[model samples]
Target chain A: MNSEIRRLTTTERRQEHCDVLVIGGGTAGSMAALTAAQNGADVLLVDKAHVRHSGALAMGMDGVNNAVIPGKATPEEYVREITIANDGIVDQRTLMQTARRGFGMIQRLESYGVKFERDEHDEYAVRQVHRRGSYVLPMPEGRDVKKVLYRALRLAKVRSTNRVMVVRLLKDGNRAAGVVGFDSRSGNLVTISAKAVILATGAAGRLGLPASGYLYGTYENPTNSGDGHSLAYHAGAELTGLECFQINPLIKDYNGPACAYVAGPFGAYTVNSEGNRFVDCDYWSGQMMAEVAEEVASGRGPVYLRLSHLPSDTISTIEGILHTTERPTRGTFHANRGHDYRTRDVEMHISEIGFCSGHSSSGVWVNEKAATTVPGLYAAGDLACVPHNYMIGAFVYGELAALSAIEHGRSSSIVDPDESQVEAAIDAIYPPLSNPDGLPQPQVEYKLRRFVNDYVAPPKSATKMEIALEHFERTKTEIARLGARSPHELMRCAEVSVIRDCAEMATRASLFRTESRWGLYHQRSDFPDRDNARWFCHSILRKDSAGAMEMSTRPVAPYVVPVEGFEFPTTAAGDGEPDAA
Target chain B: MPSVLSRTEVPVSIDADLCVTGCRLCVDMCPLDSLAIDPETSKAYMYVDECWYCGPCAARCPVGAVSVNMPLLLR
Candidate 1:
């Protein structure tokens, strides 16, 4: 493979057929591609960036938690932890199955040569603890994890194409057979036909912020413009949990690039404008400074996170306790110690860093088998919402999704779509390429971002959401006028189309559920309180006749008792047992 | 490929008041050994060719004065 291949420049229509086509080469996508290939399926992994820098890769290798200790933890115990953390909104069956298979997944990761921290006793260290069932762990930075996973994908010989944007799913009746997308560099339409399609295309955070809307460069990896969610929805897959959105609170406030002094080494506390400590002081003890924004958001302060100095030994003690190998030196720490720089100085400064638990929680709803309502199409990772009370539940569910998809692919026969279905999807994009007077790509994206952020973001009230829906309805009319000058521009237009579809669905779901629950920030003043008896059901959104959004409710899967006790050690932290680090 | 532009233009400056007390924290943290105090200015100056834009020096400037701009786009 020549690394120096010149960037593609012309529109070349090419097609590749495979047994499994996995969109988005992030953590879950990498795992899915490898698993399918290992199971004797030809796999095609596509990503928006030239590199495999999806959300998971960018965030570093995450804390993989499982109950592996003898006598201290069980699958049931793990399930209880997730349910409690979710505040009764999690799907119990999916939670248990993910917990039960958590160890096997870690073993798979270890087989790929990804090294985890170990104790001085030469045993795998367990660093995670459960607080009221919310499993939390220390995540090493992003680069280390990406290197290990890239190696694993290479070892499996999975074929991948970078800078390819999947615009829509090619469907056969109700099942998904393939996807149609464009190569970003060369303005050409390309299609990948497959027997099964797994959407690992991560979250929709970028859809909310305008400046960083490009798939990899923006607030998110810019590439994650909710194409997978939109593709699945348009293919008639039932989308759930679109209402929950995560807001990352620990972002750097403007005060001249966050001094490594305040955030990195000094262990400074975040205070709001009025200078009050807002976050739960005792919780997040190790990263006590990290939760400053979240504490303020829940109405702890008039503004959000502000920094305060801590004792000199506080930083060193935390580093020593976490056994950090790379620690900041004293001289480096001293330079960043000034308080004169305030929030008004930087571009997109983060006054506080608070992330909505929703980003990890909401997604396409899947069953215990990791199968979406639409057959042959599966979702995993942050894209699929498998109810888990704890944060570490995502790693567990990612493994479960891989296993379920592998099983589904193996047992079921592959069905290729007829020519007409592919033609329909091709026709949707052909007009933009053919027409002389089409609206530019940037204009379409600007309109799409404004509509979603205004309607779908936190502080989502019924009136505001209704107004957002009206804006989306009007924007759909404007889509016909949008044009693309190049392949990349065409893909952006298609991406905005998908975002419009998702935003409309999210609005309908938000409107249907009147009461405030987990992730639905207290925007709706009237419908406050977690009404378990009345609003406990999962809000399922689907497209109805005439292609309008429709909403319905369904009961959450009940928790089942395990046949035998799987012994796992419980940490002093009390939520559940940690995985063999 | 031959370098697109033959010579790279480099920018340099010094703040004498930044080192009034003669502290050497900036020199100690420079991973590339690029900075040295000039006797004339009594302040740190980059050796130009040896500098790496790791940004540690700028981040560690005690009075929050040091600033460096490296134009290599990693992309």
Candidate 2:
């Protein structure tokens, strides 16, 4: 039977051994691998795409969204801001790790030739994007961030294996032994044995279908197909606040951020069709998004990012930064549409919902040290649930996870690869290749994400969520019937299964929370009120021993910095702003 | 259903005249893994309709052979 399973797909097999294995080569995975290798651990960083361009930072970032710089902002103050922004459901200890160490991480990146904007005084040019504090630090020359990280990874001698989509973590009695995956180009089975594994595969960005009707058009890099979320859940790691989805205001059809954080300080704000500012702040809080959603659904339906009010020179400056970094196609997107920042307000709409800890509190639950609930398994980056931890936070937690993983690797010996688990993983990955005449991957994935957008996008109701669960249940069989014409398509087919799993997890967590919280993020239409006494705790989702998804709650940890006198504004402030939909 | 040849302009295009036949930089830089080397032409081309139009293919091109146009839908 084992031989038959091995022969199911006639592809090459390869094995590797490392002291620490990082399963992504993006922003956090790059840092984690560099840190581990610099600390003298044998590290192997794996990515589904080339390490030079992978994950959210594939095109490099535009700015540091949460930089806790010295003299400008204290870690405690930053923590309070995020706690309020995330609606007070955060582990301060975990957030403090990012807040306290993010500055050092930024300096570390600077050491790698990455640049950050500084004023004439040479102090970091931090801008105000949050409701209370200034945390946004611009990176005008950030387009080469990935190139710099890639160069740093090479210098550190971290062995990077690109184009391998790691599907499962090999477990030895709750300790992560290694990972099993297949090559995206060649369909080769890859098993890496390691003392510890760090999961940095980013957000479940591909869960919801984009309004453009394009399967690959996603807010985060489409490569981040909920692989980490599904892998973590399957490995019994608790995922926190899956109900707290990441919904941003983005360029309609384009599906990328209107990037108010970059332009907000430059005087760009979201406005209704009547050219009135409905929301006070452009910072991406659930409350702000709730306001945006409200105005869009109301008589003031279509909103625009009001950039026309800014001076042409100022718009040019904003364009110089925006068009060059992150999604550089923003310039082309505008140019092709005959829209100019000087003449027209860029049309804006609510983005398709996704599970991301970089923006919201939805990810594999990790402690301050970046260790998951399961030992020997660590998580960082957007997938690690350090609430609202952006790029700098990813670097901070990556460093923390690397340090902890190195220590853990030293104390533990490599466990033998679990044969049964490897066989099962191979069996799961090769089905699509064998059934080449089965349903195409794109069609199956499109339907699954469409279900995500239809039944689970937001303004959640119990009945809608139940129906979503039913569709997801049926999609499981559909996933089994998926076909792939090549190894590349096989990788996408495997990703569809991952997306389906995430959709179900999101639905289950939304149902379990039972009360409306986090503004539009987990807003329950049936239960429209915030029930702090009953639902203020963190909702955790994990796979049970019986292989069924289970949910439970963990009390919000005692605050390190006490927040007082701040009224919990459950709904959007009324200024003709509609309720959270 | 029978397949029919459909014509549509893709977001990414390679100037094969300028492209180095052996270099796969643009193909490897695509996050969606959309670009691939054509065996017949020995030049990189967009193999799938799954482009994010993110421009890494063009950005990473050493010879400036790659151009990522805005997809028609967005255009």
In order of listing, the candidates' clash counts read: 32, 0
Top candidate when judged by lDDT against the true structure: 2
Candidate 1: tens digits of C-alpha lDDT, residues A1-581: 01111122113566787877788777677777777778787888888753333443442433434434323366777776555544455566777766676656656666766555455785555533454332333334322565577777888898998767887788766677788776765655677777778887876644564322322223333456677777777777777756654444322321122322223323444456556645443222212323433444455443432332444465444333222212222222222443222322111122211121223356786776667787778887667776432223445554555666666667555555465655666656545655436776555667667666655665567888889888888887678777665554566677777767767766777778787765333234457555665666667776677766778776654446432222121311222111111
DockQ of each: 0.03, 0.70
TM-score for chain A as predicted in candidate 1: 0.78
Alpha carbon lDDT of each predicted model:
0.55, 0.87
Clash pairs, model 2 backbone: none
Task: TM-score each candidate.
Answer: 0.71, 0.95
How far in Å is the alpha carbon of A235 misplaced in model 1?
A: 1.0
lDDT by residue for model 2 (A1-581), tens: 23432543334578889999999988889999999999999999999989988989888889989998999999999999998998788878988998889888888889989999999999999998887889999888999999999998998878989899998899987799999998888778898999999999999999898888778778888889999999999998888899999999899888678878888888888789998889987788889889999999999979988889889999999999888899898888888778898989888888888999999989999888998988899999999998899899889888989999999988887877888999889877888787768887877888988989989988999999999999999998898888777889889999998998999999999999889988899899999998876776788888988999999887777678888743333432222211121
**lDDT (Cα, tens digit) per residue for candidate 2, span B1-75:** 233445767888889899998998888788888888899999888878888788888887889998878677656
